[model samples]
Target chain A: MSDADRVKVPRPVARFDDVTRRFDGGLVALDRVSLSVHEGEFVSVVGPSGCGKSTLLSLLAGLTAPDAGRVWRRDARPGEVGMVFQEATLMPWADVRANVMLPLTLLGEPRGACARRADEALARVGLDGFAHARPFELSGGMRMRAAIARALVTRPRLLLLDEPFGALDEMTREAMNDQLLDLWASSGLTCVFVTHSLYEAVYLSTRVVLMSPRPGRIQAEHRVDWPYPRGEAFRADPSFTHLRSALSVRLREDAVTPEGGAGP
Target chain B: MNGASGRAYLRWLAPLALAVAVVVLWEVLVHVFAVPVYRLPAPSAIALALYDGHSTLLESAWHTLSLALIAFVLAVAGGILLAIAFTRSRLVEAALYPYAVVLQVTPVVAIAPLILIWVGLDNAPLAVVILAWVVAFFPVLSNMTLGLRAVDPGLRALFRLYGAGAWQELRLLRLPASLPYLLSAMKVSAGLSLVGVVVAEFVAGAGTSPGLAWRILEAGNRLQTPRMFAALVLLAAIGVALFIALSCLERRVLSRWHESRR
Candidate 1:
């Protein structure tokens, strides 16, 4: 396809126009969900626990389907949806290299072809010399790294993360967020990061979509203006603090009062 | 209590001292009690019996070893085949597994004569002896199957994502995972196979292929207590040799990967 035919950057597209997702017992997980994510955009969706945050990812990855409406992506092909689950989903029996190489192998690439790429992917994730180490040998943070490597090995255009570091300690999670940001900036890949932490959402996303509880609906959306080359200082900014507190207030109101007031 | 010496090597002392003490106690007890040679022979008398009956004992020992070898091979073949079938599905495991348990649980002595009759073919008597070999074979298979499937789910998923087929998964992951279980099972089966051969001798006495079991029987009938003890010790020796060999193999293979090696 010609350059003109291709969609523009920062206009990277995820289409979920009028999407409605209903479970078996008429539990609506998503209602009329319409959102678009531009190319190379970092988007985080936050909600209370059991708010179908994971279900959104599942829909995007085609692991499950939306009950109504479409989730269409023009830039990414079907095979390019790389998903990282909440758990460190690395294969415990597989060494680091083999675990990362999994997507390539699943795509039916030859072993000789994937071998060096697998090593490179591991090295890229800071698991350079530990290529032969099993998942059990690695720490929780390291194992999550291996999991991320597996997702990136395929060079996916659209990455879907479902609370990827929710289980990690605060310090490790911060380190991971920086690493993830660096990777995202370097690779120029669009990401949909699902998180429960308001600070994390504000910290990582260029666009933050706050979701309301059970029968989930998007309560509001905010465009984060924190400049990139975003350092620890950006997190300490008054603007960052105000945005976080505002988002938390909106989330609290959405749950307890079942009413969403207009933003100031 | 938790000193470095607490983890000190315990090499050979326990067994060596136990053997020496047992021999010394046997000598003193027999001398003090004046136990007749026809009843329980002293260790020295048994040693003498071993010295005198060297040629005959060697012959019978060889016979017994050969029988046990053949029976063990049969058991291994049968066990491995059944194990493969069992691991394939819950249905196959349920159907074929129970009969194996029946084969094991039935007393060898009571069934030996009946097995001798039922063979109705050449080496039928030998076959009856081999029947005892079938006992405990599946324990190895059962344990091995458990080990093979015991791989972590995440690991299994990794393999799947790599597009590894069933054969590759089995060859690389399943079989290697099952090695410890297989080795332990081999240890148990090895000891049992030896016992099976000797028991067969008790049933099919004084035949051309009659083993140490026949010698044991003959010595007992003739009031040759020392000869009986000598044969028992030799059997014990064979069992020890096989057990030690299997243990070495287990250690050698696992030491590189397993922490228990240290």
Candidate 2:
């Protein structure tokens, strides 16, 4: 879509307005970062290591507060936000069903209702038969599926994923990417995904936000105009390759040009 | 037999064979050297003593076992409760944890005589149980506190995002996360409790209805060396039995998820 059309987008379901976050020992994790994620938008934040990508997601998830500026969530309600970490983070002692049921259980839902909801969430994530299996009994991808099932069980409006596929093999990562897109599409859930892989950002996101390290700030934003249900054909398309390479070149330039007062 | 089962068989057989060899050699050497029965009795003589005093020995064993079991249950319950309190309030932990460490390092033997006197000879069994509980409480407290605090940061954040209250987090996450640590601590404390009971009985003298340690002391005074050896044998058997039982419990609890079980 043209820039003119982009300006016509509706109100954001979640937004960060000129936000800044600082850690202990005077480290600036983010600096005046403004981003907005509208309902049903698949937005990916891409940055190198130590580039405040996670801090961005953490702020959006309300896991951490910004040092300055405003974090707004439209119609914020209990259990309205779900987060998936880089690791599966499943309770080693709990079975998949119990793990998925945890949010509802904590909310004081009835036992029968929690069980039915957990089973439904498991089925949504294609984990129907593995509800009774322990976390250790699952493969890497399957364990991550269990984690997603857990996050999705609460039926949150917005999902924040922090490099959820980083630990998976390449083939498994691609499969999970496709599955995540399907989940996002069918559920009408807004997603703010963080990753370092430009290819992944380009393949899965409606808009890619590039961040630079050393007091992280948004360096660029690219609108991906690819149609929905993007598949292997999109990966082989010349436009996909051009956009990915252009992002890579911009990232390389940022890496070479060191910011003053930033440590090596 | 297949290799795995053959290896399992050998694991049991080797220890049994070694024990039998040691006993037979002891019996043979006592006979060959003509050692006085007062100094070192033959295995057969000790066995005869055990058979002759079977009723008395069994009674003493039962008394000691009961004291140890009571003390063990109290230690586990008290330790876990204290650990939960510590996790909930940093001020409580800071105020009380040093005293716990001091209690652990003071040596139960040094305090047993004082404990016996304070509790009075009329309540000697209670004194023994108290001493044993003191000895067995520290491992569970320290290990469980560490385990409760060792929750994965991601999981902690998830719990927070889901708005789990303190009690819910403890029941669903902290308590289950700390189980492997608690079970291992229980194993260590089990052995310590048995040791504590025997030492406390020794210090409490014959006032506590003649536990095995008292039987050992009584036999020593009369120069019934075989009976003393029999008492020692029973004590060793009790210790081994407790360890094996605890190990089996640990296996049952941790076999599904714990890395140590694997």
Candidate 3:
């Protein structure tokens, strides 16, 4: 099926109620932060560095529990979760296929099944032929591609991404953004991605959530009413420019806030 | 590059040539000095002595080598057990460890006489040989334990999170990591084992079912200098052979998984 036809199947998803997470010894990392992610939605969370954005993704991935908060997969959707860490974090000693197949291996899935799924995922990330190569052999962008492939191989109901391309060069980052958009659109996966990139947030996201600092809370949300299966043409559009500028202004305001009290 | 390669060749060839040259010189020097055949024997004279007394020399070598082998095994086994107990409980390490240290540091020369006196005759010297084994063992056991315990806490936590039990983690990861340290200890201890065997033999040889040390002394008393040198050469050969064998063993076992092999 063509990419345009793929985005129509899985409708958007949302989470009800707030998420509050507090650490021991009276440190609150998240305070009543609530966000909804519809199926086939490409949402970006743009905020100050310690805005509990990554923590929010971690909670969605079931990696960390939120104190006094409940998370949901939204009714009527078959649920599965995938997470990509900020760093590629591929197993150094293992090759790309082996690294991507780790979760499947851990889950005790047969080697042949994991191999096929891994190959398909690698192809989805445009990394089909680089399967047997070790992580050290790959460049930064390729490593992140492998990490993304690993996350997507499970074909989960929800995809949680935290700055997956933050370490790449500008050229590579833009290319990865297009690829990710294509993947999300075609797979109809709900993605709640955390990023500090204003242009990336505005360009790739269907909805953008700007967050405030310490005991992180949502500051603002913007919806991008653009066509799906976006390409380089969309990146040049006036609407993209306007959204980026507005998001930049809010981020700057949060940054210069003297109290430094709202984020992280 | 030429110099380095030549130097590498010279490292082996030079020593071998020197050995041959020394034998020739000794053979010629005795005739030139008119040194009494008894007082300062020539290389030929020692060869003659060995030929004449071949049975006795070979028998003594067997005795000494067997003693060294047996004592070395006992020392390694007992020391490893003691080390495990010591490492497991800090209080035990603190408690019974003074003796391990005393055993390691105290000169075998001083203790051989006492050990001989306490154990008295029959196998006392063999027991003394085991003292050398004990001396050789602690460094390996201590170093290996340290290496085993030195696994990264991050990896440890990851393995724990993955549900790897203690034995599985140790067998799969900890043991391999600690191997280099253990092999290094074995290299030193292998040489030490030979030294311990000889020293124990030297002190205890005069008393009874003697080893090569007694043969050396008996030959020396009769001014059988070549015989004495022959025995020393045999002992040196044994030590070299043991060292090489152990080094090969260490390399073979570790090369499969370790950086050293790579």
For DockQ, candidate 2 versus 3, the one ahead is 2
Q: Considering only N, C-alpha and C atoms within 3 Å, which residue pairs clash in candidate 3?
A: A12-A38, A12-A39, A13-A37, A13-A38, A13-A39, A50-A264, A213-A262, A213-A263, A214-A262, A214-A263
In terms of lDDT, which candidate is stronger, 2 or 3?
2
Over B1-262, each residue of candidate 3 has an lDDT whose tens digit, in order, gives 9998899899889999999999899889888989987677888877887788788888888877777777667666665666556556789888888877887888887787777777777776656566667666777667766767776553443344234556656655566556767777777777787778778777766758567888888888877788897787778878888788888988887654334452
- Evaluate residue A218 in candidate 1 and report its C-alpha lDDT on the 0 to 100 scale: 84
Worst 10 residues of 3 chain A by lDDT: A72-81
Prediction 2 TM-score vs. true? 0.96
Chain B only, TM-score of each candidate: 0.90, 0.96, 0.85
What TM-score would every model get versus the actual structure?
A: 0.77, 0.96, 0.61
- Candidate 1: give the clashing pairs: A12-A38, A12-A39, A92-B155
Over the full model, what C-alpha lDDT does candidate 3 score relative to the true structure?
0.75
Ranking by lDDT: 2, 1, 3
lDDT: worst 10-residue window of model 1 chain B: B1-10
Higher-scoring candidate on TM-score, 2 or 3? 2
Model 1 error, position A54 (Å): 5.3
As for TM-score, the candidate ahead, 1 or 3, is 1
- The DockQ values of the predictions, listed in order, are 0.18, 0.75, 0.11
Residue A56 local lDDT, model 3: 77
Model 2 Cα displacement at A120 (Å)? 0.9
How high is each candidate's interface RMSD, in Å?
Answer: 4.7, 1.3, 6.4
lDDT (Cα, tens digit) per residue for candidate 2, span A3-52: 87777865589888999999777799999999888988999999998889
